[model samples]
Target: MDPDDGEGLFSDAFPTRELPPASAFPGQDPHALGGARDNILEVAIGREVRSFRNKLGITVADLAAATGLSLGMLSKIENGVTSPSLTTLQTLSRALGVPVTAFFRRFEERREAVFVKAGEGLLIERRGTRAGHQYRLLGHNAGNTGRVVVEPYVITLTEESDVFPLFQHSGLEFIYMLEGEVIYRHADKLYHLTPGDSLFFDADAPHGPDEMRQLPIRFLSIISYAKDEV
Candidate 1:
């Protein structure tokens, strides 16, 4: 898939509203879709990023310097103007002392039940080459509870993509290989994953796809965290 090409594999967009609380979903796990299960993960990246920044009282300039990114770029990312690359995200994680997963948190519990169906996943296609490809919402409006988000996705390497940009966010990520194979790049390390194989990693580590992509890879990913804790 061409990064510049806007045509997505799943053409239809998913329907979404605010999610219910973590308790409503049970297990404090975001990966568990209670009703009408589908192949996607729920992510509130925007809310998470803002929460972390606000909590730390970090300015865009401060974050840019710490992440080795330009102030303008960092501002764009925070303001929803641009999507930071995996590498850019890693830089921020290192500077923040929080796991890369910290970039994906929500401070409030969800109130409504939200569902993302196949062929209609909601996405945060912010300005930038790298988009926050959120497959589903873990839970929402639940008062300070925890939940997990499980999603299925395919990583298609572009001819221009020499490496998967390093990224970190605000939770734990469990990746289960489904189809194809690719090198999974974690901070200063690389791991090859195949079908049925899985890996658990800290969200704050700089991670992304390895450059040696011989095929389009598919995987099931679960992200989990407690909203109240943050």
Candidate 2:
């Protein structure tokens, strides 16, 4: 959707996605939104990667040879089943004449901001249209580049999240707990995190929060930096 063409200089910014539920993260279900968010991001990445390659008339084989990666791996990365390592992504980015970060650019045509009151934040909900998990964009498309975007969100936990394998990339995620408690799963370890506790880690490691508290969990998740070229 397009941002409303009203007001001043930044008026033409890209529009954000629809507002998801704002309810505090329920402890039981957090992974509900993982699949959908992952899917959207995956599709976005796939489209960008393919578009860039197609623009160069570069075939899968051509990319494979240029990047010194296996065609099978490249195919899997593009398909979203697996994320590429930084070195591999850098090679591909160089070959494409764009920054590795270019792959993560979110081409949101519309951008707007939604403010949630202290007691009136919208609930993050799971609808049949998408999957489980709900969120609201903290700011207008502030940081949407595939490599780095500063998105603050109130993530709700409604289900037990599965162990997300490590995501091999170059980025740092800083999460500040605003309310309730959660379990941060990294690799084979689990760390219990509560409100006010901040956690920062590499985006390359497959990591996600597990809602174990009965009360809803809310946090500010920040992707401080991404190493993609674009």
Candidate 3:
């Protein structure tokens, strides 16, 4: 029971109960991706194997024959139903003409990031939309070959900005008001958003700004959509 241990339940510097878990989030995030960590490595390996096999124009049967593994075993491995041993992975690597490490490439891939300086974001033109709105592309993953694509933008509306209602698109959208008050429409619903306010909605239905309650409005818009099928 040393007070200097800093392991006490109510320690000033390292209180155990006060620290949040690694996966704990600040608040309810509308557009936040779920935190599911189960079988991620297996899934990544399976996808990589399948992708390589397909790229080589080889079927599962062909892969099995090349690796001297059974059809059922290869099927299980490719579907990520079971984890393969190092020997099995080596066999797959040889048969697929890839390195054994390639199977885990996706699972061990480095996390990517993009940083934009203040007032350095790229300006974007909104097609098929009225004028007076300024769209700045804050950040986006460059040439990401992943399953999901995310685009973040900062939208500013001035007195001359046209209120374009009903914008239809695919995927999900999130908005956080930064500078002004506005009424936003999503499908049949309307939300009055002020500074620090937020909204999340499905983009498949029509949605857009309904009214500008305050001038020089600015907001962050984050959109998430699935990548096109290869």
Per-residue C-alpha lDDT of model 1 across residues 186-210, encoded as one tens digit per residue: 5655566778978777767777775
Error of 3 at 61 (Å): 23
Per-model TM values vs. the true structure = 0.40, 0.37, 0.58
Query: How well is each residue in 71-140 modelled by candidate 2, as lDDT tens digits?
Result: 8987887776676677877888898999977988753433445676665544443221133345654543
Question: By TM-score, how accurate is candidate 3?
Answer: 0.58
Candidate 2 lDDT score relative to the true structure: 0.60
**Which candidate has the highest TM-score of all?**
3
Scored against the true structure, residue 203 in model 2 reaches a CA lDDT of 62
Once superposed on the true structure, which residue ranges of model 2 sit more than 4 Å away at CA?
A: 1-131, 140-148, 159-170, 227-230
Q: Write the per-residue lDDT of candidate 3 for residues 38-157, one digit (tens) a residue.
A: 238877788899999999998998998898999998888777788899999998999899998888887887676788999879987774236578889987764776788788999989
Q: Where does candidate 3 stray beyond 4 Å?
A: 1-99, 107-110
RMSD of each: 21.8, 20.4, 14.5
- Which model, 1 or 3, shows the larger TM-score? 3
Q: What local distance difference test score does each model get? A: 0.56, 0.60, 0.79
Better of 1 and 2 by lDDT: 2
